[model samples]
Every structure is written in structure tokens, then in C-alpha cells.
Target: MHSLFILSVMLSTAVAAPFGLVAKRPLDDRDWTRSKRDGCPAYLTEGQYEFPHYMTQVSKSEPNLAFGPQYNGIFTPNDVSTVFSFDIPESRANDTCTLQFIFPRQEQLKTSSYAYEGTGTFVFTGYNPGNCPGPQTTYNNQPGNGPFPQFPPIHMEPGYAYTIDVGPCSVGAGTCVAGMTSTNDTYFSYFQDKDSCPIGIYTSYS
Candidate 1:
């Protein structure tokens, strides 16, 4: 009877476990940089640069894990883009999920030498496979105003792979400093249970 009880408890714990993914930097070139001759802006580029990747905390006691492509270079006005694609489990197809973009806090940015304050426009798009489904969902926002802009809860189709495109644009006068700093790690968190997300992930700013 005790063994049965233990099995039931384990099952329930697994069911209640949070489902999500964290963003991370590349391992090989984890500490590299781009210069003006190498495509970075002369005035904006400084310090070490790293490739963008997705990460997840597989174990609570361990640090975040990194995955996905290792795109080189920096985020410049001419090319401020990064893409992350992931698959949703079939079990989550009916469940409501929330997508969030997590940015480093202002205090954290101050610690980085390459950090800069400026206005920039970012375009986010979710694409369906093969273009079979027309009219994909998209979100656009200004990153300079604040951090943690999130999309409304969505019902994602299970067993399907979805791609998220992040394109940052510089507005007039101000330079778009998206993906500019090495100290800053931009994260995209996917929550299967919306309530499981911490209060800090939600922001009042648009």
C-alpha cells in the first residue's frame, strides 16, 4: 500500500511540474565579440559578443541549459534579428499558454560596459508550418520603454513546430540597441500554466 501511495505521489508531482523553456548563449563561442569591420557598428559595438540560443532549467538545483542555433555577430540597426523554433507537446495543444520576452533589469544593464539606453522597435511573429495556414500572429513593441512585454495566452497546436522571429528596428534619432550588450541575456519563456509564471515576468509597460 505504501509503495502504491508513493507511485501516486510521484505521478502527481510530474503532472504538476511546470512546462517552459529559457533562453541562453552558445557554449562554444560563449564569449566572443563583433567589431565594425566584422559587421558591428563602430560606435555601438563594444565588449564580448555571444550567439543567441534557447535554454531551460531542467533541474531546479542546476543552472539554466542552452540549445538551438548559434547565430554570430551583434544586433545592429541594419540587422537586428534572431529566431527560435520549438515544438509543443501534444498534451498542451488544448491548454492555454503564454509567451513572454524577458529582459535584463535596468540595474543589471548598468553593470555591463556595452549597455546603452535608446529607442528601438521590435517585431515578433509566429509562423505556421508550410504556409498552409494563412495569417500568422505577430506582436510589435518598443523595448526602450520597458522590459517584459508578453503576448496574450494562446492555444498552441500540439505536435507542431512553431518559429518566433524577433526583428529589432532603430527609430529616428535613437539607435536600436537590441542584442547589443553581452551582459544582457534576452529570454523567451513559454508557460503551459499561465499562473505558474512569477509576478516579476509581467510588466505594466507595453
Candidate 2:
């Protein structure tokens, strides 16, 4: 009975996604390059930079004015950047997963800055799983794909992984505040829970 409940929920989610959760193929070595693949960024070439690189920055509140750059104060707004690479092994090529970009608690920011519930965006770039269709515009990847095809949200295969380039995107477009730098962006690969071909990956850019 318990299993049936879970199955029902999964089915519901699959029905919601358009692409469906199954894939016809996996990316090969040639698939990873620009010549063979269309929509690759200018920075991506035959053999130069790799797939993943970290993007980081730091800011604080207080009033030292000495520690790098002050954003909202050491307590107002802060920023940090890092890169990560993942390997999705062929063994678990057909599973479901999700990549999330967590943010600092609202209470952690100054009262002046703590204005909304979800008021930030993360800038992102890098190689996208071949299953995801696109010309690869904007730092934030949208209209792309994730692991789960049928489900609106993306899913990831347990073993197979892709690298992403991430960074802190400035908010408001105004000058950097005393202690706040901006927000972080991230992407993800996911497996939709719809059909038989169950392995795939995509990213998040908003």
C-alpha cells in the first residue's frame, strides 16, 4: 500500500513534465566538444578549459573597510563562490536526482536588505547535458532540460554527473552595498519519472 502511494505521486509528477523522463542515448566523448555539438559557448573549444570551474567572492557587514570588499557590513549581506565537478557513472545511468542552490537565511541579512521571501538570482554557465536542448544563452539556463523528462523539475542519474560554472550575480545593478556582494546561481541535471528511458540531466539558470 505504501509503495502504491509513492508510485501514484511519482506518476503525477511525470505527467506534469513535457519532455518525459526517458532518454534515447547518453553523451559520448565527441558529444562533449563543440565541433560535433551545436550551441556550445565560445569559451568551449576543441581542448582548452575543462567543463567545471569554481566561482567565488566574499563580502561582510561591520565597518572594517579593510577585509576585501564590504557588502552589507559583516552582517548585512555576504557572498561566496565555489566550483564543483561531478561524475555520473554508467552504472547508474538511469536514476533520478536534483541539484539545488541554497541561499543564506533571510534573518542573516540586515533588516534593510531582508525585504522579500525569495529575492535573488544566481548566474551560471558551463557544459549542459546533451539531452538538454538549447543555444545556451544567458548566465541562467532556461528552456533547457533536466534528468526527469516528464516531470517539470529535473532529476539526475545516480552515477553520471556533469560539471557547471557558477558565480555570484549582482542584485539591483546599483553599486555594491557596504556588505553585500550579490546572489549565487546554480544549475542541475535530473531524471523525469515518466517513461522507460530513465536517464538524463539539465541545468537551472534563473
Candidate 3:
């Protein structure tokens, strides 16, 4: 079975989470410049930049099956883990800014009877030799995606955008590989991916 998990994963009551386990900044349209993804800036600056993921990888005993990251729908059920590759322009690398994985809720998968559980502890890590998603990046890539901190799962409701800040480590690292896995495997925890596609996953950095 899926035994690998972060120390923070634990049994908890079900309720809406106003805040996630990891730090998430309020939608502050402060001094940050106009949000856009025209191209890499001369250097890192104080602004929220939008970027799309190049590719995604899923790990499962069976190949060619849709689940986890592979599923046009990112349900993240079972023991499946996923990785997303992003090509951070050398100029975009910086230690001060944070890299965030943004997942917009498309629809609710579970029914009204289904009690939503907070997402179990989510572990985000940096893959070595971070390269843009390619043929080599697969679901079985658990070897080098590690040595990162685990954050408690967050309660997610539809209509709101969820953000997972993977830290600045991948900011300057060219071909940054960001990975995610849930320690909690429950109906309420990962019920976000039920019917429609949630592949609109992207990243935001400032």
C-alpha cells in the first residue's frame, strides 16, 4: 500500500479551511505590477507572474491509465503521485520570490452526502536536474523528488483558487520540476477531482 507520508499527516475533523497548512498570501494586488506572462523579466521583481505547466507525470503500477496527474482530471486518488515541470527563465530565478502551484476548482466530484475532508498533508518537493517536462519524466520518478517539507492538507471548496507554494528553490533552477503527493487518502480529502477536468493547473510567482 502507499506508506510514504509526511509526519504532519494525521486524523482531523472535517471543516472548511480558511487557511492552508502552508503559508498563502491573500490576493494582494499591492505594489505588485500588472499581472501578466508576456515573458521573463530582466530579473526577479515584486509582482505576481502567471505561467503554465509544461508537462505532468503520474506514478502507478499500471501505465497508460488515467489517474493522478495523468488523468485529464487531476483527482490524485490512491497512492498516485504527480510532478509538473516548468521552464524558469534563467532571469526569473531568485531567492526572494516564492513559486506557487495554482489549481482552480472546476467542479465538485463528490456528492452532497460526501463529507469533505481536508486534503491530507501535501508534500511538495524539487526534482533534481530539474528539466522541463519531457519523455523521461514519468510517474515512477520518486527517486530524486525529495528532501522537502510537508504541509498539512487544506480544506478546499469550489469557486476559490487553491495555491501550493513550493518555495523559491525552483525559482532560479532552470527546468524546475515541482512534485506533489497527499499523505491523506480519504473521500473528503481528495474529492475535488470528481467529474470535470482540473488540468488547468498553473503557477504564480512574485
Candidate 4:
């Protein structure tokens, strides 16, 4: 009969995929309780907004793709290694997301010379939130903020730990520059301190 209706439409399209809608009733521990717990949304997703568009080169400025040089991932001219990422949602269990890369302190204190800086960090953790209570820990922000001094939590059963920072510009001139990685670590890099003096460092991923 048409090969059994093409194997029942390929098993009904794999049971309406989407990981088959998960949850086959198995969440023990009082059904994984967690009611009304707020205080973990410092900026991620709803974390980028700046406007004033209307110009034709007003002294040329506005090339701050988070840290200038088109975020130097090196492909020509002059590189400064710059890359970032975010997009984590496997169901978002126990919710907790914070992402900020605001590095532009008065344009790195007015260009120290050539302009370049340094910073690096990383952390991520996921899986099993349906039966939580133990095996839970997190950190990556808390310490005047910038260049993580406290790190731990980069294990989501897939991949993590993507840190890179090559530089030589730290004569106490860091107007603004921050780092913290783990959107499940796909890639990361930070190296732009050409003597300092470049603005635009606003990135958030939740």
C-alpha cells in the first residue's frame, strides 16, 4: 500500500520532533521544585542598545564592534584577535544568565599609544536541572567585574573552555574591557589594546 504509506509518513515525522518534546515523566525529588527565585539576569539577550545614526563621517568614529578593528579575527591589514558568542537554550533549566563586555572607558583613557589591551575568561555548565539539589555551582562574575578572578562551571556534556588573550598593553590604562565566556564555548578571543583609546564595548548574551 505505497510501502505502508511510506512507513507511516516516516513514523509521523519522528513524532513531531523537537527532541520529541522531552519529559517522559521522570523528575523525582518533589517534582524538581523551584518557585519564585529572581536575581540572575544582569544582562543577556536584552543587552545592546545605542543610537544616534545620521551622519556622513563626522570626524570618523563609530567603529566599535565591541572593541574596534572590526573585531580583529585577523584576515588582513592588521589583526587584533576578537570574537564572541552566545545562544544557549536546551530548555534553560534552573535559569541563570549574565553577559556583559562593556570595554570602552572614555576610549581607553584617551589612546595611550596605538591602542590595544588584554583580558580573557570562560565558564559554562548545563544538563540535569529536572532533578537538581546537588551538583549545582556557578561563578564568573563578582570582583569589581572584569577578567574573571573567579571561575568554575563549564561543563554541559558537550563542550566549553574557550579562552585566548595575547597582548602587551597594561600600564594601568584600562578604561573599560571585560571578559567572561560560555555560551557553551564555541570560540573566544580577546586582544586589542593598541595603546588604548577606542570606544564601543557593549555585548550581552543570555
C-alpha lDDT of all candidate models, in order: 0.20, 0.21, 0.35, 0.20
Query: Sorted by TM-score, highest first, which candidate order results?
Result: 3, 1, 2, 4
lDDT of 3 by residue, 109-197 (tens): 12212233334334444444353344555555442533443344554433333344434533334554444444335322222221232
After superposition, the stretches of candidate 4 with alpha carbons farther than 4 Å from their true spots are 1-148, 153-174, 180-206
Q: What would you estimate as the lDDT of candidate 2?
A: 0.21
Which prediction has the highest TM-score against the true structure? 3
Model 2 regions more than 4 Å off: 1-82, 104-119, 128-206
Most accurate candidate by lDDT: 3
Candidate scoring better on lDDT of 2 and 3 = 3
Q: For candidate 4, report its TM-score.
A: 0.18
In model 1, the Cα lDDT at residue 152 comes to 17
RMSD over all Cα atoms, model 3: 10.2
Per-residue C-alpha lDDT of model 1 across residues 34-108, encoded as one tens digit per residue: 332332111111221111122111111221222123222122222233322222233333333222332322222
lDDT of 2 by residue, 25-110 (tens): 22333332333333222222233212211111222232222232112111111233112222333332232322222121222212
Q: Which RMSD does model 1 reach against the true structure?
A: 21.2
